[model samples]
Target: MPFESIQGRGATRNAVPARFNLPERLVEGDWLDEVEALDGVSQRRTTITVERPKSILTRNSSPDIGFDRSINPYRGCEHGCIYCFARPTHAYHDLSPGVDFESRLFVKPDAAKLLHAALSRPGYDVAPIALGTNTDPYQPIEGRFRITRSVIELLTETGHPFTITTKSNRVLRDLDLIAPAAHRGLAAVAVSVTSLDPAISRTLEPRAPAGLKRIEAIRRLNDAGVPTLLAVAPIIPQITDHELERIVAAGAEAGARVAFYLPVRLPHEVAPLFRAWLDDHYPDRAAKVMATIQSMRGGKDNDPNFFTRMQGHGPWADLLRTRFAAATRKADLGTGRLKLRRDLFRAPEGRQMRLL
Candidate 1:
């Protein structure tokens, strides 16, 4: 059977002459047949593209999130974590939130420029700006683009306070800037460590730095006198949940001053991608994992309710929370109250002119 290609956005036709008509949304996974029949398909290398958003900071009103304004220098994280909650955001650009979300990415080349402009606005209130909120600002592409670094430099120059959340140790590269900012009460960082198991880290967050390296990053940041927090996010029930205590213990050992965790969220396309990942990696335990998730999600794949979304409700969720609390206490993480200094915020010079 000769392969037939389908055209733009319509019902999928038979790619293999007459194998059988599958749904337009589904395509057969026969690489040999595809290579033999299509020259163009075989010649493409997945390349990264730059997207110039007119603005950099995104405003949000969700009660669950702490920040009102956040900046993401890149879209479609290269870390390729199958459980990424930000994956569905790609669909808004008419791109698939699956493979395309991990491969075909968009970097905001003008991110630093736009951020300077936004921050310089006369009415721009100086609160702690959040970075790596939607997509990781320090993801792999950052090594080349260096947009995240530029933004950090700009923030530091203006004496602005900011917060960062990232899973990659690549953030350490900007320590020269971050350390000084921390000295001035202008910065805080949260390093997200999902699991201590290297193998699980590999499959769960395929392209992110190894867990050990992230621990090292935590150590390095804290050693430099930077305020560091350990984020044990997306505690997948029955799967990675068992490692929560170990992860928290390790973070405390590495000198993390604070710790936090959130339940796994599956919004839109992410649900199917995560399910597929489970089927591929942990087929035997997939059903139990999802059942546990459902128990927390009010008997569904997810619960989008604001506060409920971050921390699910149920026995499993409750137990996970209790365990995390106990482990952090045992490890002496966050021994006493610590808070980011908002008093250090000062409007960057020339904000009014820049906004104009």
Candidate 2:
């Protein structure tokens, strides 16, 4: 298969990862051959697989990240972001991390029920549960599944503090539930805006909402008393680096109280997928971009060190930090933490409690 940009998808090719030792899927002549003759090439459609897990809470002890536990309502985001670090997880299902990670999705319909069980457990501890930690909770399928909404309703009923991170404006649909929780300081939101340029955004994250719409979402979320932050994540060097100050300024103007950024990190399978994306979109400067990224990563594709992983090293990394700091100051957006209150948590009612 040749490398060509799909109409609405991000990955150029569905290369099977070598680490998994999975055999590549080949096209054999059959009924599909007749269909291909009628219609040149087949278009891949989104497929959803239902998953029912016994537990919903994911606990992580990474020293670099802020939260200790989180919830993901869905797997394999349809937003199709070329640089998504979560793509490698699809390999666990014997699926290609490239296109399969985008088109083949999984939804946990039992998320709310599992969450209720966990919260109702004896001696259950309470901490802020982050949403959209691994994959987006508000991807397009969310409109129909409404699993995220169900989880939020349960969290709100129990007064559990939580935070949401997403690139979609669909979150506003749940303003009725989130606004009240935010008023009690139990909820916060961070909207990730990759770039303000429509063309750049379209090619980079083909299915995510436009950047301007996300900025508007921040404005509305803040207007509803929700502590919304601007997340300029995976700031691509040379490509989106120039928009650092501008993006910060835009976020501040939209009433975001604080803003944060992470330099592009390509770990595991993301590196090659990203390379393919660069070849398709930014061929002119792909080499220059990779060179600068390597310099920040100690002349490698990625740096996995704790502190340095989130914040890169070298002069190029230093320049980004300096530029980000100045831009935040100029835009009056704080780089400080937006904490959510955990004291308001109350365990969900168990069978005995409900009977009582």
Top candidate (TM-score): 2
lDDT (10s digit) by residue, model 1, range 92-136? 655566665765588888988888788767777777789999889
Best by lDDT: 2
Worst 10 residues of 1 by lDDT: 9-18
Q: What is the lDDT of candidate 2?
A: 0.89
lDDT of each: 0.79, 0.89
Q: What TM-score against the true fold does each predicted structure earn?
A: 0.86, 0.95
**Could you give me the TM-score of model 1 versus the true structure?**
0.86
Per-residue lDDT of model 2, residues 137-212, tens digit only: 9899999999999999999999999999999999999999999999999999999999999999888898999999
Error of 2 at 126 (Å): 1.2
> What shift in Å separates residue 179 of candidate 1 from its native position after superposition?
0.5
